[model samples]
Target: MTNTETQVPLARFGISAVEIARVVAVFYARVRSHEVLGPVFAAHVADWPEHEDKIARFWRNAILREKSYSGNPMREHVSRPDVKAEHFPLWLGLFHDVLRTELPERTALQWGALADRIGEGFRTGIVAMRQPKDQPPKLF
Candidate 1:
């Protein structure tokens, strides 16, 4: 586990709650209008504003260690049959576009790197979920 004291704060990279909120708001707006992502999110999210607020909180918790957000992101995504593993790339592409446009180059690069790492985690979890229960972990 990473010690909070040792971990570098995202704010050092110019990632504040304000920046998190902006990214969530703008990225989701594009997602809602996107040809591929729109339908997937629309089916689950009833209130756009409320969903955005929750997502912003999630980003704050993740990036800022606010400890104010709730819900299991991996469980949420894995539960959705429509959220295929391939969708991670699509999601990251749009998120990267939003991050680059909303933040300065250095900040965007840092934040995008973090997002890439997290997206890989989610994709790995989803892949594990699809594995056969009777199958044992491979021995190297």
Candidate 2:
């Protein structure tokens, strides 16, 4: 519960390209219509189709470690000042919801765990990236 630590959730394991694509597609559809997260995405992403493809590719690479994606996701999110740590749960929830319905129970649980870990990492990075200007720096 320290200031430097965050709530880390457990995750599971990978998947196929088509399944990954479906997960991304369903998840983004919910995100686009989400009241809280919709605006955040819309503000940063102008092209939904392109963004969706990149995201699908990113997930595919992350899950399979296929080395297909090249984008630095941490840097991308950290650069967005409007993105807060609180938003991770909302995004993760939507992702899990879509996975459960579109995928098998085991598949959903595995990806749910993976998504949780990813969200935690992203949140931690975002918080660290947003440290106050006057805060003392620490090497950890």
Candidate 3:
């Protein structure tokens, strides 16, 4: 079977809270230093520790389904005028890189898939938000 035909079992390779914290820490460190994404993130996130913790909560909720993430991520991303659809790919690419470097293959793939979906959703939301006021709203 082709690689695409193989299904990754959802519950088999779960990430621990410590792993999540590690990923978040390393990932943001890279992001903070990146040429393309760094300035954009720095402009909005004045407090790194608070922002990192919030992001960890987001990933914890996403990967472990812990229900700890309460913020409206799409709304938050949309509010950042410097954030464009073009940046989402950069962000996701960085995320994928960190996951591959820090995690086992199956674990990285699982988290990467979830990150991709979230990135796509954020991209779509940002694009829809950019549409002219007269245009009909895109389905959420």
Give each model's clash number. Answer: 0, 1, 0
The 0-to-1 C-alpha lDDT of every candidate, in the order given, reads 0.87, 0.82, 0.88
Q: TM-scores, in order shown? A: 0.85, 0.84, 0.86
Query: lDDT of model 2 at residue 83?
Result: 88
Which digits, one per residue and each the tens of the lDDT, describe model 3 over residues 1-140?
75347653243257888999999999999999999999999999999889999999988777766677898989998988999989999999999999999999999999999889989999998989888999988764
Candidate with best lDDT: 3
> Which lDDT tens digits does candidate 1 get at residues 1-140?
55567774444355788889989999999999999989999999999999999989887887787877999999999999888778889999999999989999998898899899999889888878876889984321
Model 2 clash pairs?
Answer: 11-113
lDDT of 2: 0.82
Worst 10 residues of 1 by lDDT: 6-15
Model 1: CA > 4 A from native: 1-12, 134-140
**What TM-score, to 2 decimals, does candidate 2 have?**
0.84
lDDT for each residue of candidate 2 in 1-140, tens digit (9 for 90 to 100)? 85238543222254677888877888888999999999999999999888888998887777876567888999999998888888998888888889989999998898888789888999888877788878875332
The better-scoring model by lDDT among 1 and 3 is 3
- Cα lDDT for residue 62, candidate 3: 75
Taking all chains together, the TM-score of candidate 3 against the true structure is 0.86
Q: Rank all candidate structures by their lDDT, best first, as comma-separated numbers.
A: 3, 1, 2
In Å, residue 107's CA in model 1 sits off its true spot by 0.6
Runs in model 3 lying further than 4 Å from the true structure: 1-12, 135-140
Worst 10 residues of 3 by lDDT: 3-12
